[model samples]
Every structure is written in C-alpha cells, then in structure tokens.
Target: MASFDKKPTFAGLKLRLMNSWMFVAFFIGFFLFWEYSVLWFDIPLYILTPPSLIIENGAADLPRLLDYTLVTGTEVIIGYVLAVVLALPLGLAIAFSTILKRTIYPFIVCIEMVPKIAFAPLFISWLGFGLLPKVIIVFLVCFFPIVLNAILAFNSLSEELTLFSRSTGAGIWRTFFKVRLPAALPQCFVGFKYAAINATVGAAIAEFIGSDEGLGFYIQIVTGNMRPDLAFAGIFFLTLLGLCLFGLVTLAERLLIPWHISVRRN
Candidate 1:
C-alpha cells in the first residue's frame, strides 16, 4: 500500500499563515495609512492626531491610562457578574412559569424600553459618584440581553425532543442537564457576547455622565485641553478593554459548547 501522508507545500503553509495573521496585518496596515495620511494632509494636531503621536502620547501616559482602565474594568466586571447571576435564573423561571411571563416579564420589558443611559444621572444622584452607580449602569446594559437570550434558548427546545426525553423516563433535572442546558447554551452565548460588548459602553457612559476618573473622563478632559492625541490614546485603551471583555465571553462559549456547530466551525 502506498503511504497516504504527504509533505506540506509552501502554498499551504503560506495560506495558513495568512489565515492566522490576517487581522493583525490589517491592523498594522490601517494605522500605517492613518499615520501617513495625517502627515500628507497636514491635518492639524488638535483636529486629528496621527496614530504615531497617539502611541507616543499613550506610552508617556501609560500609568494614568492603566489606572483609568482599572476603574472602568472594575465596574464592568462587577456589573457583568451581577447581571449574569440574576438574569440566568430569572430567565429560566420566566421560561418555565406562566405567572412570571405574564407579570414580571412585561415589567422587565417596560424597564428595558427606557434608554439605559438616561438612568445614569438618577443613579448618580441616588448612589453618589461612587462605584455603585457605574456598576448599576453596566448591570442594566448587560441584564436584558442575557435574560432575553436565556428565555429564547430555553423555549427553543422542539416538541419532539421533549417527548423523547419524557419517553426515556428522565426526571426533570436529568432532562434539563442532559438535553435542555446543552442545547440552550449556544443561544445563551449569543446574549453573553452581546452583553460583553455593551458592558464597556455602559461603564464608559456612566463615567462620562459623572465621575472623576476612568477612560471616558480622561478622554473628556484631554479633549477639553485640546490634546487630541491624548484623547485618541484614551480611546485606544477603551477599545482594547472592550475587545478583552468580548474575547473572554467568546472563550467561555468555546469551552462550554465545544461540540456546538458554531464552535466546531470556528
């Protein structure tokens, strides 16, 4: 019998490298273009600083930026955790119970209808300029997506699957653990990913409304001082923070649902 194994070709190696590093290459190319475009256009620094200057300024002020990042990150973490802890159970309850669906669900919908940002000032007034208000904002932003997704995930079980589980003589808990939970996890992760994206926004907006520190406040202060480079630096860190949060949620999804079609495809 002939050996089936073949040596890797140069083209295959190059393709794999491109697939793995495409985003990094694009990021570097984009910033290089931005840097040169600003220099070529003679754009005023106050209007739009080049990426080079933004990096220089950010490096110089790394400690301060890190401090503000920590503050914002703290709020995001606390709020996200709280939202997940409460929302999942509540979602499950609402999915299973008609009473909750009729009563509490509508109330939640009404609350979610209001723009979460609008509540920042009220929370600040009530909770003061402390961390609690910012945490509350993050919680609100994360809560609805998770709860709504959880409800949808739990309800999405097919009638056939339900009958099959019943026929197997599985108890409620067994059915939930073996079938419902796994099936629902993929959709639940959709909410988690969305909530992760919003968590950063919620914290930053809350800080923007009323806070002495955080990347949002830093950006505002730098902008008022006509330091566009520093403002852009703040934005860069904020973007990094958001990416980190999103990455964590994605990692969790992959770990928990490795057998899922989405995870398998990835």
Candidate 2:
C-alpha cells in the first residue's frame, strides 16, 4: 500500500495563519472603537469602562481572579464528566431497549421540561454552600442534551447498515462498536458541544444563587459594590472560559470523527 500521510507545508500553513491574524485584527479593531466611543461620549467610568481599564485592573487583580476561576472551572469539568458518565450508558440502554424507550423516556422528557435553574436553589439547600451543589447543577443542566442526541444518533442509523454488519458474522456487540458507534459519533459529538457550552453557565448560575467563590459570585459581588468595570472584567474572563471549553470539544470532534463527512468538509 502506498502511504498517503502528509504534513502540511509552510505554504499551506500560511493560509491558516493569515486567517487567524485577520480574526485578531478584527478583535483589536472592535476594542479600539469601543474604547474611543466610551471616552468620546464621556460615559461614566462606573457605567462603561474602557477595555484598557478592564485589562489593567484585571491584571492587577489576576491572582484573586485566577483563584475563583479555578473553582468555577473545576465545577464545570467535574459536572461535564459526571453528565457524560451517566448519560452515555443510560442513553445506550434506552436506545437498545424498547421498554426503556416506552416507560422511562417520557418521564425523562417531563423532567427536562422543568426549568433546570429552579433546582439550583434546591441543590444548594440540600448540599449546602459548597462545590457539590454547583457540580450537581451543571450535571443536571448538561445531561439531557447528551442523552437526547445519543438516542437520535442510534435511531438515525439505517436498518440496512445493522443487517449488513450481522451478515458479516459480527455479533451485536461487534456490530455496535464497529458499525453503529461510528455512525452515531457525529450526533454524539453534537450533544457534547451543546453540553460543553451549557456546563459553564450551569456552574455560574449555581454560584450566583449560593456560593462564596467562582466567577459568577465574583461578578455578583463587584456589580453590587457599584464597580461595573470590574464586573465587566469578570464577564470577559467568563467568556474566555466558555470559548476555551467549546474549542476543546470541537477539537475532539474533529479528531475522533475525521472520516465523517462534516469533519472532512470543515
């Protein structure tokens, strides 16, 4: 067999680098305009702080911000892992069994219909003002999307594909792992992306409702103290956290499903 693996040359890499630079340029331009607009309009410092001020103060307060950041990041990561652990097996079981689909799935939908944020206070009351409650809140918020996507992925596989795998002398487990799992991976990743985005929000909500630490609590404190600039700084960091998590999930999808059409197209 002829080997086809090839590393991207510098010329090819140059295009991607230029694209990234364009994004950075646009980002810088946006902030410059924002800073100028705020300064020119004589906006109150407490009302709208310039980007420079946010960066300066944020850097000065980096240590405290980092400490709280780790707290929130921990909650999001732990909750995400737990949701995946619980959802994947449950989803598989539900997909494989009509009993689960008929009996348990309806109740699951009903539970999903209830606002997940409403349970944040209950979790705090039950678990107290600690990491546990925040993690549970994240788990509850992220779990449903994963399970639903899993079910959709499994059902979307054509019947002919399953029959073909069996005809090749593959048992149920072999067929699932080889044929069905690969087919389902794209949709599974779709769930993962959504869950990743929601995970941070869930942790933040829990912190806002009842916690002494984390970025959400930090934002609440700063806003209450009439320091909108510092609150905006917190918001900036929170946005970065969400984007980083979402990027990681996207990278994983690209790696794991490289042969999938969507991955190839991208």
Candidate 3:
C-alpha cells in the first residue's frame, strides 16, 4: 500500500510564512524603525518617546495598567452584551411590526444621528463617576449598529425561503431557528464586529470625560504629568484591549457561522 503522508515542501512553507509570519515581520520591522528613527532624529523624550522606553515604562507599571485594563474591559463586556441581547429581539419586532416601524424606528434613528460622545459628560453628571455611565456609553454606541443590521438581515430574507419553509409544514419558531436565523447570522455578524470596535471607544471616551480608573483616565493623568512614555503605554494597553474584544467577536462569528461564504473566504 502506498503511504498517504507527505513531507512539507518549500511551497507549503512559503504559503505558511506568507499567511502568518508576514504580519509578525511587519509589526517587528515597524517598531524597530520607529525606535531608531526617534533616536536618530534626537526627538525629545517628552514629545516622542521611543518604543524601548515605552516598553520599559509600561512593564514597570504593569500592575497598575492591568487594573485600569480590567476596569475598562468590564465596562466594554457588560455594555456590549447588554446591547446585543436587547437589540436582536427589538430589531426582529421592528422588522415585522408596522407599529414599531413607525414609532420606535424613527426615535432610534434620531438617537443614532446624535453624536454619542456628547452624551458622555451628561452620563457622568447623572450617574456620578461610577462604572454605570461608562457601560451606558458603550451600550449606546454598540446598540444602533446591531439593531439596524438585524432589521436589514431579517428583511433581506427571500420570499422563496419563507415559502419553502411553509411548504415543509415548519412552524414559525422552527422556521426562524432552522431557516431565518441561520440565513440572518452572517449579516448580523457584520454589525457585531462593528459594535465590538465601538464598545472600546465608547468606554474610553466616557473614562476621558469622567472616571477615576481605566486606561483612558490613566493616559490623561500621565499626559498631564508630562509622561508621554507612560501615556503611550496606556494607549498601547487600550489598543490591545480593543483588539482582544474585537477578536472575541470575530471568533464568535467563526464559531456560529462557519458555513457562511464570508467566513469561508477568509
């Protein structure tokens, strides 16, 4: 019998490197260039701290940074979860019901039109410097996209799909779970990815306006104290947090809708 196993070839190695190692190589090269460029230009530490110093300072303050990260992460997770949980049902109702379409939809549109960041200060004042305000801000920022996408997803289902489900004697709930929900999920995930990005920003903006802890507050304090290196470190942490949240949403999309053409293309 012929053996089925094959050794890895140069082409396979090249493909793997191109797919995975390219990003790592680019990140390393970019930071290395940044570090040397700042040194070569004799850039003032206060104005533009090099990556080496940023890493050193951030590592030194890792414990406090982790605390701030936790605060912001909690706000983002809670608010994002709340938005997703509530928006789906509301979107479905709005898509199906004329009354909600006429009444609630217009109000939602008005809310979406207003700048979300402007509400941060008011939320702070109303809720005091608690976590609730930051969570609310995150919720507001995430809610609209999810709702709009859900409505679009539900409405975009073809009449033929519905008729086929009915022809099979599928009940409303069965059709929703088996046909409607699966068809809708790919589009819905687009909103989820968008909301995940916004959740971090909303929390940061809220913290910037008023809060005692969080990466945003930490950056503001360090910047005011003329510690640009520390500020950069805080910013780096904030970005990492956002990336982690976004990664979670992307992972969920992959898990829930692995058969989608968008997921398969990736």
Candidate 4:
C-alpha cells in the first residue's frame, strides 16, 4: 500500500511561515493565547472577556451588528463618493490655474488644518441626528487627502510632456485625457486607499456624536451597559470593514496601474 502522508520538510515549513498564511496563523495564535490567559487569570467578563466569549457574543449579536454595519458602511460609501466627485474638479482647478492654486488652496489647507473631530458636533447640530450629518462628517474627514493627492498627481507632470502633446496638435481636452489623467491615476489611487480607511473612522465618529444606529452607536451602548465583549465585537467588525475597503482600493490600484513601477514590483 502507498503511504498516505509524508513528513513535513523544513523548507516547506519555512516557506509556509514566510507567506500570508503566517499572518492568519499569528492572529489565530494570538486569540488562542488571549483566551487561555483570560481564563487562567480569572478575569472578569466586564473587565476583559476571552476571545471565545467575544466570539459567542458576536454570533448572538450578529444580526443586529450587521444591521449597524450596513448603516455605517452606507455612510462611508456615500461620503467617499461625494468627496471624489467634489475634490477632483477642484483639484484640477488647483493644478491648472495659478490663481486658484495660490488663493483657494491656502484656505482649503487652513480648513484641513483644523481637527476633524472638532467638526463632528457642528455637523450633528447642523444636520441633526440623521444620515446626512454622518455622511457630511465622513466627507470632511476624507476630502483633504483626495484633493491634495489629486493636485499633486496632476501637477507632477513635466512641462516637456505638455509641450509635446501640444506639438502633436492634441487639443487641451485630449492632452489632459490621454496624458495627464493616465499619469495621475496611480497617485489618485493612493488617495483612494487613504480615504477608504479614513471613511470608516469618520463614520464611526459621526455615529458616536449623534446617532441611534451604526457600529459606533452599538459599541457606545454596549460599553455603557458594561458589556465589553460585545463592544469589542462591534470594534472587530469595524476593523474588518476598514481592512476590506482598503484591500479593495489596493486591488483596484494594482489592476488599473499594472504598468506603474510600484504595481509591477508588487
């Protein structure tokens, strides 16, 4: 009879530990250790629940948590879309017009300099405890990075390229579409990646400030009820959402800019 199993080789084990699988293994190991330590230390559930308990609570609360997650996710998506729509044209204006670049950009920079959290209460008061306020807060949090990066991308092109396009009889729109836009796409994605992560935090902050819905509100309620495990479960979902969004943006960037040195190397 043929043998069904082979001994694990050192090389095979080393390769496995060096790749993405190792990340998954490390997280599993951490949670296992956390569970064992909590039990061994006789920690109170309210103070620090074990991973197992947190999982249990998550399973029990999954439906409600998912509902909240959906609400928060909607706000993040809407805000990010709005920021993109508004920031791009403004960024182009900043890049193409000397007056706008020198004048309006300073005011924009000054506005961005203010702490984003400071505006949460103002947004809530202005828009009330509704989706509008949450979306606006998320927009404010993510808008700056998109605009700044877009301007940088647009302006990074050499004057030689612009003259070359003009020499070829390419119209302004054609030059912009064919040359500058393609050149700017990679950096635009960098902004998108940053915005994706920030949008989640922004939504959470908005929810925390004034809302009965979303993961942030759920966490607040659970924490107030002294259910740290459930609160942490909500946090876990938010983290997953942010990571997923960031990953999606990264994937899109790689797909769109495969010719770019950064993408090719990766």
Candidate 5:
C-alpha cells in the first residue's frame, strides 16, 4: 500500500513518476560505466561492445528485426492460445473426473520432466521444418502452467458455494459458468503470466534448433559467426518481443478480471 501525508493530488502523481525515473537514471549510469570499462580496459569488443554499437547495429537491423519479432510474437500467441483452449477443458476434466486425475495427471507430469531441447529435433522431424515445430514447442512449454493453474483453481472453489447453487437448482453448466469460472480467472491469469514469458523462450529454443527465420535463428547464426554485436541485436529484439507479450498478458488481466482486487491501487 502507498502512504501519504494527506489526500491524493496531482503533485502526488508527479512525485510517483519522478521516483520511477530514479531507477531509469540508475540503469543509465550503470550502463555508461560498463561501456567506459569496455573502452578503458581494452576488453574483447565482442564480450563487451558498448551499447553504442549495440544500438547502432540494433537500429540497422530494426526493419528486418521488427518483421522477425512479429514471427516470434505470432508463434508465442498461437501457442499460448492453443494452450489456453486445451487447458481449461482438459484441466476441468482431470479435476472433476477421478480416472483422469489418477491416470492422466501423472503422464502429463512425466512429459514435462523431459527436457524440451531433447525433443525439439523430433518435433521438427514430425512437424517438418516450418513454423509448426516452433509453435508446437511453444505450446508444449506453456501448456503445463495453464493446466496446473486450472486444476488448482477448480479445486479451490468453495464446496458450499457449489452445493448452494446446486440446491438452488442450478445445473452444472450454470454453476461452472457463473461461479467456478469467474473465481478461477485470477488463478488462470497467474498461470498466464508464466505461460506468456515461457512461450517466447520456447519459440526461441525451437528456432535455435531448426527453422530459417526468427530472432533465435538470427542469434544462432550470428553467435556462431562470433559477431556479438549482431547477436546482441537479436537479443535486443527478443527482449522487445517478450516485453510486448508480457504487456499484452497484463492488459488482458485488467480487462478480464477488473474485480480481481490485485491490481487495484489504494
């Protein structure tokens, strides 16, 4: 919670914004010091190229980088969409059905235990060398979070509320839609937060293994060529893409769960 000497005013907002800028200033200073160190210590340019070169190369790559960023972003979204679409029903099934809870849940965990990298080549073989494999990888990485969160959310609902609604003659569908689902949204979004971030990394990993496009592919080839500046460009774009998707998830949370109380400012 935020404390104040008195009631809120425009000055308070200004002060808050000013306080936020302090961190930005600190970051600027730290980077400046690091950049100077690269120049002063005669460091291998590749290991510690100043942000100047990073910015220049990154800007040079911006047009193409933006296009590639879109590809990765789309892969992340499609995979996450697929995960959400599949997770809810599957999770509810596992939660509500004894057989699924007993038999399916363990198998799901077993699949997650295997390193995704080990399976990337197999995914490429089966899906072929295209966007499909990366999409599948993203889906695989993101799917578990949603499933776990859904299972928890569904199970966490009040039994009394379910009983009361049933006693009041609500059907299962009605009860689930009105009570259980709305209650589960906060949990779903908590899952979404992790899923969103991991999906991007998953696509990057997939692209590193296969595919001819994407920032990951760029980084893979660039790093091998020992051009760290260009590699940094790829990384910069990766960070940009991740931030955009994370922002989307946060925005969706606001719209979908405004009553969540978690985001409400005091």
Candidate 6:
C-alpha cells in the first residue's frame, strides 16, 4: 500500500490557507459585481441583488431556513445511514462470492442504467409523501457506487499475497481478516463518500416530489413565491450539506487508510 504523509510543511499550510482565502475573496467579489451591476446598468434589482441584500434575507429568515434545514438534514443523515447499512454486507457478499456476484450484478446494472428521478413519483406512490420516499431516493442514488467500488476493491487485492498466505497455511477467514479486508477498505470509504454526496441531491429531489418540508421543499416553496434569493440561499445550504458529508468521508478515509495513496496527499 502507498503512504501519504504530506510533511505538514509551513509553506504548504500557507498555500492551502491562501487558496481558501482566495475562494472567500472570489465569493465576495461576485457580490461586488452584482452590486455594481445594480448601480451601473440599472438592471432589475431582483435579478441581481447584492450579497448584502441576499444575506440580509438569510439573516432575517434564518429561523425559518434553519427549521427547514433541520428537516432536510435529518433526511440526508437517515438516508445515508441506510445506504451504508444495506451496501456493506451486500457489497461483501457480491465481491467475495462469484456465484452471488454473477446472479446480482446484471440486475444491479440494469437498475443503475435507469435514471432514478423518473421513478420519484413511483416512490411517492409506494412510500407516500413522507420521510420514506426521501430516504428511499437517497438509497437508490447512493447504493450503486458503494456496491461497485467495494467489488472493485475486493477484487484488486493481490492474488499472489493471498496464495502466499494460503501456502503458509492461513485459513480463508484469517487471510481475509488480515489482508483482503484492509486492502479493500480505502475503496469502501471512497464509495461511501461519493454515495453520500449524491444522496443529498436524491433527498432533495424526493422532497420536491412529495414532502411538505426540508431543504428541497423549501426551495420549491420559495421559487413558487418568486423568491430567487431565498432559493439561492437554500441552494447554498444544500451545497454546504453535501460538501460537509464529503469532507467527513475524506477524514474517515484518512483515518482508515492513512497508507493508501488516494488519501496521503494533502
């Protein structure tokens, strides 16, 4: 396995900090552009409200947005958890057993090819206009990466190493526990990270189709009321949620597979 110590150099840290500062500066600059457009071009104010105005709306309506955020946040968490639980054992089974993989792989591929959004209404019909649909949607969006990535990782374990272990009289279970499982772990977390990222969008779409609350529902409500600024704020919150999940996955990957090349570089 590859190692990933970034040296934690002062210059590296400084450069990373500068990158973040640049991002913030760019964000502020966008708002400045909007402000200037409003003043200079005599454009429709609503079309290009300055960042301050947008934030004022967020500040004034945070309680409402926060309330909705809690609802959506809950759905994202629940749905992501469900994906992990279902994907883990299932992935292991598919990866470790050729028989199971052959039987299930085709079915999964077929389902994967279908756009899940097309069936959002079906989910609503079957699960009703509640948390169930949102959770199911999240799972549907996320489950594939988990399964596929796990299978790939499981297969990528060095066969020569396994043969050596077997020749040394290590039993199958012992070899798996000592070697294959650890080798596959980096990819397992990778799948989870990607799944969680997509799941946030899934949760929102499901909420849009049926639910009366959550971030998606909030976006729907605001857009209907001609409140694009509030909608953009909701979008901002949604991006934060997804990015936070991805960051957490990255952290977990670092912890679990510090030696894996994918995680070592800062």
Compared with the true structure, what per-residue lDDT tens digits does model 5 show for residues 45-110?
A: 766688888889878878888888888878888988999899878988998999999999989878
Residue 212, candidate 4: C-alpha displacement in angstroms: 0.6
Q: How far is candidate 2 from the true structure (C-alpha RMSD, Å)?
A: 2.2
Please give each candidate's TM-score.
0.91, 0.92, 0.92, 0.90, 0.90, 0.90
34-143 per-residue lDDT for model 1 (tens digits): 99989899998999998878889889999999999999999999999999999999999999999999999899889889899899999999998889999999999999
- For model 3, the local distance difference test gives 0.91
What does candidate 4 score on TM?
0.90
Candidate 2 residue runs with Cα over 4 Å from true position: 1-8, 17-25
**CA displacement after TM-score superposition, residue 178 of candidate 2 (Å):** 1.5
Candidate 6 lowest-lDDT run of ten: 1-10
For model 2 the TM-score comes to 0.92
> Which residue pairs in candidate 2 have backbone atoms (N, alpha carbon, C) closer than 3 angstroms, thus clashing?
none
Task: Give all candidates' CA lDDT scores.
Answer: 0.91, 0.89, 0.91, 0.88, 0.84, 0.83
Q: All candidates: CA RMSD in angstroms?
A: 4.3, 2.2, 3.9, 6.5, 3.6, 2.6
RMSD of 3: 3.9
Please, what are the lDDT tens digits per residue for candidate 4 over residues 4-96? Answer: 224689997888777868789889999899989998998888889998899998899999999998999889888988998999889889999
Candidate 4 Cα errors over 4 Å, as ranges: 1-25
